[model samples]
Target chain A: MQKTALTRRTLLLPAVVILLGLSIFPLLFSLALSFGDWGLGRGIPYEWRGLSNYAALLADGRYRNAAFNTVLYVVVTVSIQYVLGLALAWGLFLRPPGGRIFRVLFIFPMMLAPVAVGYMWRLMFQSRIGAANFFLAALGFEPVRWLSARWFAMSVVMMAEIWQWTPFMFLFLYAALMNVPTSPIDAALVDGASRFQVFRHIVLPMLMPISIAVIMLRAVEAVKILDTVYVITHGGPGNTTESLTMYGYNVGLQYFNLGYAAAIAYTLLLVVVAIAIPVIIFFKKEVSYT
Target chain B: MIRLNSVQRWSLFVALVLWAIIVIFPLYWMVTTTFKLRADIYAGPALIPWVDFVPTLEHWARVVARYQQVTRAMANSAVAGLASAAAATFIGGMAGYGLTRFQYKLGFLRNRDIAFWILSNRVLPPIVLVLPIFIMFRTAGLVDSRAGLAIVYTMFNLPIAAWLMLEYFKQIPIDLDESAKVDGATYMQILTRIALPLARPGIIATFLVCLMFAWNEFIYALILTFSRAQTLPLVVAGQATQHGPQWWDIAVMATITIAPLLLVTILLGNRLIAGLTAGWGQ
Candidate 1:
């Protein structure tokens, strides 16, 4: 019979190969491209421009707007999603009538295409001929142009994100809630502590690790947001809701400026990595706790 | 334990139901709007379907007939998602087997490092590498093709699959594989016939989870394809702005995209939950 070591190596190599090919190769390729000035049209050729691309993004109004929008959207949406998600998790744990079916219902949005979700909202948010405005008029408020105005359009985009991702937070927080030791909660209850006190003093503290994990994870993901916003407003009104990825797409694919686009994409990666490192550390601690 | 009073319990129930309805209304709105006519969907503050208007299948039929890419894109997404997930699961299962069943030492890095290295791939966002991958695909003539997209998704999903399967493999007792080996079964045979079969539920969960991700993917498909290899999500995104999106039609398209996920949710509820907590929920 053949040795197990050989079998293990053979078995493991494909995954290693595919992972490296996908990640490291593109990482290096993008890293190299980021340092050059390359474009297709107007007879522009690949020329060395060390740090120029990164430096240029500093003063670009559009890039700054995208950066600001990305930060604003992530902060607003992640905070709303976390609060709602935790409350929903607590609600689910309470097991109200018909709660089981709702668990299934809640996750459907998170699973559907973000693009599809965006399209549904886009239809709903249509200015004159849409259901959202129809309700606004019914409520005695004037019909507002949701996607035509920068603030409203961005709000609409964030709404789509919050609507879709809150379920994700719910599922994770709910799972963590299940894992929390019941001993502390039971002791708090037997001590005649109030419901809010029991939760705040014991349960919430117990859930802190998971809360941090979930928040950090979702925060990292929020920074990478693209598909939904792309469909909802296409970074529109005046680049108000534009994200780093959207801008990169426009520059790289639409504008055919590969080098600068690569730089933009690299910046996105760096920003995400900065946030993700702490998350990685948290999970590592979680591993030891478990 | 303190008993919740009727008033408290009832209020809690109401609050829970309200929360769930708020969560579920968009999907309900999508379905109801699909059945409503263009004028009705456009004109309405009506949230309820039966009370709002009579439903019709005209838009549903038109979604198929009008957008020729509707069916094609769905099929493309299926192929890409299913194929990549299957590949990822198979390869990842083997890798998981390697990680769980055997030990290896490499220079300066151990097996744990390799596993985490794979895990690290999952953390990077799709758009970061889309440009470089697009350039590579362009040079290799692989862009806008199903195989190329599947390959991308395979890499996209393989890490999670491996991580998940590694956990699954640990749960399964190693004695069975050891016994099978004692009976002269080869490593491949034991893996195929023993470990894999025992972990079938986890594998299925992993496959469905990966399939959900690849199928729902938008940006990669957007950048990598023009019209030929567009996935359903890409198609929906593209057609949403075309000719002033017919809400009814968009709803129909949206429904088609959501239906499979709903089925997966219903059929594999526990597995789906497991996959979500398995980390990298999308």
Candidate 2:
């Protein structure tokens, strides 16, 4: 293969154009659209409504509920996945025979589409004829309505999110765990350290960076997740499962309040960025260290 | 080391087996529900396929013989997936190769900045971007078109594709490029012939990932296409929705929607995870 002379000018322009249209354009346009009174009305007559959409959405009870749900969802789901994933990773790190199969199975849920996952669990969580309630009633306990109430609806959403994503944490944590130089672990074991102690001191510190990054990534994905909630709850039981993204979509697409939705979308962006910036910084630091 | 006694070993084995069952339970439920009658499905979550329960091909038959839109959506998804994979592989691959291999004397601030911008853009939520994209597509008269969806998907797929390919390309020492240059070959020739061949695994990994992203994408498909260019996820998801018809048919279609992905994941799960986490930690 012969490499002909190529100048920087030849390659840079197309990349710029792709990134511009994809990333730059949407970002700027969305920001601009947030400020205008664009909706389902005949064409967007540019009426600069400065902070009205934001103020209105903030005052709206629905947006506040969605915001609260989003924060709660992120904290609970991330915490569960992180803890469960680390436990699973440590279990697998023991490297008993057939460990590889278990590892693959652990990460299996991550591969399916979120919508499929939502449906699969929706069937499981079915109160009347669903498996979960069936088992509950079999044990002589009352079968609770999983999707019929606000708290149970949120619980079901959390359950599905955990089921789907714990595997992601397992995968990343396992990857980082695998890369942890085995000598240190072995040394701790030889020095009469228990597995738990080794994990607390030697392993957790080493895995903290990847764990942080994983939390950041999972949190971002969980925040924007619409397909699961869209399928499972449809933000239902009186807007109990309505995340910020779902709320934004409802205002924009369902209600045709484009400007209000745009503002909502921008606010969601800020929330995500607030989470993202730290992760990005952590990621850059991790990258530089390596 | 608490020396694992036989009892401990046996207990560990039991725990592993139990967890394995839990992990695979959902997948098993999905597949089995496809063959079950509606009554059997609603009848207390039978772990074993019911012996007396009649296994009817009705759901499959209904989906195949009756539903034409699903078939059309499947086709749209395939077209969108393959087109985006090819476009992303070619353009993003070239961009990946250029960013990794090409060095200008002045150092390309523009090039590095473009790469950074692409990464940041990937993090931008599609909901935030969909309206702007919708407006743009409507203005261009490309709304509700397959190509429109493809363009949007291509944009999302490109960043990771480029980043993936860049990492893969960087591993192929510049010696190849230098040697190719010594042979007085064109840069395009080196890329297409040498770098591309050496990076075949990387390309396939990237292709599978991009195709998966395209095939399974929902939000953009939901927003961009109403009836004309909707994807499999949109169709299945829409069908299963509370407002839509034939809830059991959703089980059928969800089965169908997940089958291809299941096959791909089971076959290429390792490569998929590796490709996804390539630069995340290391």
Candidate 3:
């Protein structure tokens, strides 16, 4: 027993130390920094300020836009991805010819760097020589100005987001649907239950745990989106699509407002944790096979 | 036989086929545009590359001749990805073993609480960690260094790493350890000899996941390194700013950055799918 305990400490203590060194220490340091004013790039000395940056961000338009855009993105992307991902998984379940190839292609975009993926979308969205416009002209429709307006830019960003992640969500749903029991479905079919009714009652509930899990995972990630926006829009056309992550980046790196940036970062952390806690609980319950 | 109507089956097939084509179109466009000469790209947009003009390798050539950071960035990514992945796997294995094998009573913190805390650290946005780590690393003179950035990557990877390894370790039969202990085997001996061998596939899966995280890490690298330690993603992004958006170069760089990972995932496609499945619902 003593040996077991000794070995346990020997193994776990190092991990605990590493975890603390990496997360807790930095979190505390940043928490402290958030309450103090520091403009390191401008040669300003660190000065203590109590919650001023937090107060200031309440009225900061860009911060509000970032927060709104981030939430909007999470909502749009998660819902669309989930709905479409379920559709595609059902479609793919039919085992179409060249599906083997299609699966390969479907996952291709995700394998690329988000920067590269965003850049590719940006190139395609270009006005002068974009393929989207080219195809539009061929079909006799006028080319939509993709990135000119706020809603249009958000739409394009959302498209890129959906196109990349829907495959992942589809993959998850596919696995879940495959493993779902088939006897009940066959029995319902023999009992003359309509396809939609059988699906509404049987398959849907069976897939509920997986669906919720997919949404929770996708929702958490979608909320912290930065890469595509950074590369494509750069929060352009007057800060229309700046995520809180991007807002934090601008404050810290561009404006060199370290204290305010820390505050922005902390708020983002709280928002993510707050949004994610219930989902995380549900996730634990589902994963334990309850 | 599985039951479905002919129309339903065909429609589903057609739907899958069409979407697959739509998905493949942009990726194919990106790759083919890399081969198109400046004239062809600057001119009409053709769906087929070689039919309009013979594809060229000039852009790929320019990635080496005009832009050289691609190579440096590749090297940087390899260092960080390999180092962090390997380190995290080993360290996480230890933590995982401890968690699975022993009981913990640390005042208010139970084992589940500790696990949740570790995983929740991952939920903290990179921005929260980026600024403070930048300051701390700068003060410690670890900025712009591969080791420094690898530590940060390891931090992010560690949560997943420990969690995954813990799950994998749990799958191994504890009875093996009991028998080993009866034979006077130390915990270290049992872990190294009995447990590690049984958990081999999990280790590889965990390693691959860590490498995926490390290789794709962007925000932290952007804030921490200026130029010397730039990763492939950073360099690929740099193509936009370096000379006012060289599409050809960007295509080439993006191709380089993506090809290796694509190949890795394809080769390990089944394993990756398994790992990703494990990631969901938990």
Candidate 4:
């Protein structure tokens, strides 16, 4: 009994310490930094300012634009990726003779590094000699100047994101589809249910767990997107794609406004948590079964 | 036993085939473009690289010529990635083991709290940590160092590491641990000899997940490191220099940066899928 107690204590103690060191410390440090005059060039001398950083952000147009960009990014990317991913998974789930091969081909984009994808797509989107423009002219239409225009720049960034991550969401949904019991689909078919009806009534309901998880995971990631924007536009075409992560990076690292940057970072944190908590709650309920 | 009507089957087949082409085309373009000379690339947007053009090794040669920085960056990335994987696996394994093996009395630190806290940490946009970390690392003289990058990556990776390992450990029956204990095995002995072996697949999955996170990481690498410790992405991004962008050199650099990641994606394709599934569904 004494040995059992010692063993238990040994196991529990290290786990607690690890969590405190890794999780708790970072959160506390960030909370403190958000309230101070932290900047890049000059070191932050331990001075406290209450809510001033937050106040400034609330009154800043750039912050508002960054927030809007983040929301637009998360909402558009998640919705498009989810809808497209589900469609692909549904098409792939049939286990056709070449299904394995098709699945492999589908996930090809997810394999490349995001930076590489950004570069490749950036090359393809170039106005004068890009493949996208080259193809457009071949088809006898004026080229769409993918990166030079604001709306088109944002759209191109979104395209790069969807290109890379749709595979991820597809993979999740495919696995979920594989695990879903087939009896319901069979029953629906026997009752003369159309394919769409079968999907709506049976397959989608079962795939909801996986769909929710994928959306939540991908949404949080999309909200803080940086790589493609950084590599492609550098948040350019006049800050159309200046996401909060990019915004915080510009402020803290480039502009050297640590206090304002920390506040921007914190607001981003709140938005991420606000979106994630409900999905996590949903995930817990879903995962309880398997 | 044909289940679907012919039209339905063929429609699905056609759709899959088309999208597969669409999905795979860009990747194919990247690989093929690496072979084409400057003139050939501009000649037309033909998918076939077998056209009338002399394939040159110049691009590959240029990438190889800068081998020192490439090797250094690769080393920095590998050290950070593998070390963080090791550390996260150890820490996460311990926490996972404790939560699975013992029922602690702290209501605030219950299983749900542990899982939720970890998940929330991951969901926190890493931008939130940048200011504080810059300040903290600047003070500690750890900025622009691989160790600092590793610590930051660990913070980013630990939450998912813990969550995955927790689910993985829970799936293992406790009776195995009990049986090992009954055979007079120490906790360390059981962890090393029994649980570790049994959890090999999960460990591999966790390691790959950690590696990909570390390797493909750009934001932290950008903020943390200057020229001294630049990784592959930084190198590729540097192609867009002050004297206007060199398209050929940028393409060559991109090919280098993407090669390893693509290799991993193909080689560990199934494993990467499995790891990603575990991260998402569990």
Candidate 5:
């Protein structure tokens, strides 16, 4: 028994050490740094600011704009992806012709790097010689500038996000749907329940757990939207498409305002934790009830 | 189960086909653009090879001409991804096994809290840690090194690896461990000789997922590495020049960037799905 206890500690030590050294240390350092003023490019000594950075962030218009954009982007993209993914997964559950081929193909977009996906969509949406405009021209319509306008650029970024991640939702939910027992559905159908009624009553309630889990996962990731926006718009049209992480990057890396950037980072962390807690609690309750 | 009527089935087929086109068209364009002449690419959306425009190897030739840089980036990505995945799998597999077989109490933190704490590392945004890590790496003179990048990737991938392996390990009967214990097998011996081998598929799935994340990771690679240790995503992103993005060149590089994982997805789609959805039901 003593030997077993020793071996267990030995097994877990490496992960524990690495997490504390690499992850927790940096997080704590950043948290402390958020309260001080230091700029790498400005060549200034560290000075304690006592929440001034946070105060500044509260009043910063660009920061507020970025916060708003991040919320809008996460809400729009995740909701659309969830709805479309559920529909597609349900269709596949019906076993359409070429279902296997479609499954593989649908996953292809997700396999590519987000940076590559961004560039691929950038090529498609290029104004002068791109496919989107070319098709518009072919149909005798005026070509629209895709990346120059605020809403258009935001839509393009969101579309790229949805295209890449909807497959993720579909893949998980499809697997869940496959595992769902058929006996209940059959029993309900035999009891004279209509298809829609059976679906709403039986299938959806069965799907609730996985659905919430997938959405929560997607929402958490969507809140950190950076790579696509970085490649696609660079937060262009006057920072209209800038996500919170993008703004943090600009503040920390570009301007070298490490203190303020850390504050922004902590704010993002708070946002994520806030979003995660309620969903997780609801998930726990649903799982227990089921 | 409620069966689909013929009309419903036909409409579903058409819908799937339409969505398939939407999904495939962008990828089709990416590949086709690699073979098109600049004139043809800018002239219009010439989608077909033989019908709309003549295909050429000029872009491939250009990418090949910069073979040194491209290949170096590819090698860096492969090394970092594989090393981190392997390390994370080994360590996280052990951690997972320990969590399952042994009870750990650290203050108010039990096994479940420990597991969630590890998993929460993933939930933290990379941007938040990028600067401090950058500072630390700079101080240690590890910036722009593949090893440094691998270390960071390992930290991030550990949560995923540990969580997946924990779920996978849970599926195995604890009675096996107990029986092995009665046979005088130490915990290490049981983990290595019995549990790990039994959980081989899960380990591979975990490794593949970690590799995919490391391979496609960009933000850290963007800030940490400049040129020497730059990964494939950076190479793809660097295709933008002062003049403009070279469409054909970007297409070729992006294709190379995306190909390996695409191959992995095609080959191990089901296992990958299983790994990703491991604990969803719970």
Candidate 6:
């Protein structure tokens, strides 16, 4: 028993120590920093601000806009990704001709670095000499500025995000679809059920658990959307497309407002926790039931 | 699997083809743009390599010429990504084996709680940790060092590694451990010899996933490293200059940045997909 205990400790110790030092320690430090004022760029020493940074965050319009934009981006991108991803996954699940090649090709976007994807999309949407505008002109429509406007810029960023991540959803859902038992569906089909009806009644419920899991995964990651936005828009012609992380980045790194940045970071943390906890609990319950 | 009628089959094919076009176009554009001259790149929709514009190796040649920064960055990324991934996989694999094969109670925390706690670390945005980590790294004088970047990446990748390895280890029969123990093999021996070997594919998948993230990681590389340990993503991002982004140069650099992993994905695409979705399936 003692030997087993010793072995367990030995096995677990490294991971625990690393997480403590790198993950938990930094979070604690950031939490403390959030309540202080440390503008390194301004040559100001650290000073206890006592919630002033949080107060500032609450009243900051740009911060609010960023928060809204982030939520909007997450919702829009994840939703679109889910729909498109499910459709593609269903298509692949059907075993179409050349499906193997299509499956490999589909995952290429997801494999590229988000920054590269951002740059690729940025080039495609460049105002004057862009492929988007060129195509528009060819279609006998006037070239519309893609990046300069608010919604358009947000849409472009979200488009890139969806294009990149839908493959992730497809992979997950397709994998789940493959795992789904076919007997019930076969029985349903023999009972003269329509394909749509059989999918809705039989397959959808079976896919529910994995579906929730995938969506939760994607949604949580979407909250950290920064690299693509940073490369493509840099928070845009205005701060319209700035995400929570981007705002935190600006405050922390670019502006050197460490305390305020920490506050923003903490706020983002709260948002992520809020989004994650319920789904986690629900998943736990689902697992228990199964 | 649903049997598709001819109409359904054709529609699915067309849809897949259309989506495939959307998926492949950006990559196509990136690769094609790499061969185009500066004038051709900015000269609206010079897509077809030879027909639309005369192809040139100028950008690739220039990038090859500037191999000092590019190669160093690539080397940094490779070292950091591989180091962190290897470290995370080993450590996380151990933790995973421990959780699966042992029953533990840390006060109110059980194995499940501990596992969830580790996995919850994934939900923490890098933005929140960046400042504190920056300070920590600066204080330790690890700023702009490959070791520092690797250490951080190891930590961030640990949750996924541990979680995925947990799932993988679970799939391995615990009876193997029991039988090995009865044969007078130590727990360490059982793990190293039996479990690790059995879980080799999972470990490889975990390592690859960790490597992918660490390799392509941008924000931490942006903040922590200045010059000495700047990764490829940082190098690619640095292409944006005072005189507008050097699109041709960026295309070249971006291609180089993404090419290695692109090859990995093509080769191990199915393995990656399976490994990625493995944990999520209860």
Question: TM-score of B chain for each model?
Answer: 0.92, 0.89, 0.94, 0.90, 0.96, 0.96
lDDT per residue, candidate 2, B119-193, as tens digits?
A: 667788888999888888888988888999888888888888887887788788888888988998877788788
Clashing pairs in 5: none
Clashing pairs in 4: A38-A258
Error of 6 at A279 (Å): 2.6
Cα TM-score of candidate 1? 0.95
The residue pairs in collision within model 3 are none
Q: Per-prediction count of colliding residue pairs?
A: 0, 5, 0, 1, 0, 0
- Which pairs clash (backbone N, Cα, C closer than 3 Å) in model 2? A2-B185, A3-B185, A4-B185, A4-B186, A4-B187
- What stretches of model 3 exceed 4 Å from their correct place? A94-104, A142-145, A287-290, B279-282
- Misplaced by over 4 Å in model 1 are A41-45, A288-290, B1-3, B175-186, B278-282
Best of the two (4, 6) by DockQ: 6
Q: lDDT per residue, candidate 6, A1-290, as tens digits?
A: 88778988888889999999989999999998999988775778889989999999889999999999999999999999998999898888889999988988888888888888888888788877678998998899998888889899999999899999999899989888887888998888888899899878888899887788788889999999998888888897888889999888888888888999999999888878888997778755654200
The stretch of ten residues in a row with the least summed lDDT in candidate 3 chain A is A281-290
lDDT value, residue A39 of candidate 5:
75
Ranking by DockQ: 6, 5, 1, 3, 4, 2
TM-score of 6: 0.96
Output DockQ, candidate 6: 0.65
Q: How big is the positional error of residue B234 in model 1, measured in Å on the Cα after superposition?
A: 0.8
Mind giving the per-residue lDDT tens digits that candidate 2 earns over A33-94?
78888855566576788878778876899989988998899899999999988988877777
B117-213 per-residue lDDT for model 4 (tens digits): 6656677777776666766787898888889888877777877777788778878878888898899988789888987788888988887787777
Q: Residue B44 CA error for candidate 5 (Å)?
A: 1.2
Q: List the per-model TM-score of the A chain.
A: 0.95, 0.93, 0.91, 0.92, 0.94, 0.94
At residue B38, candidate 2 shows an lDDT of 78
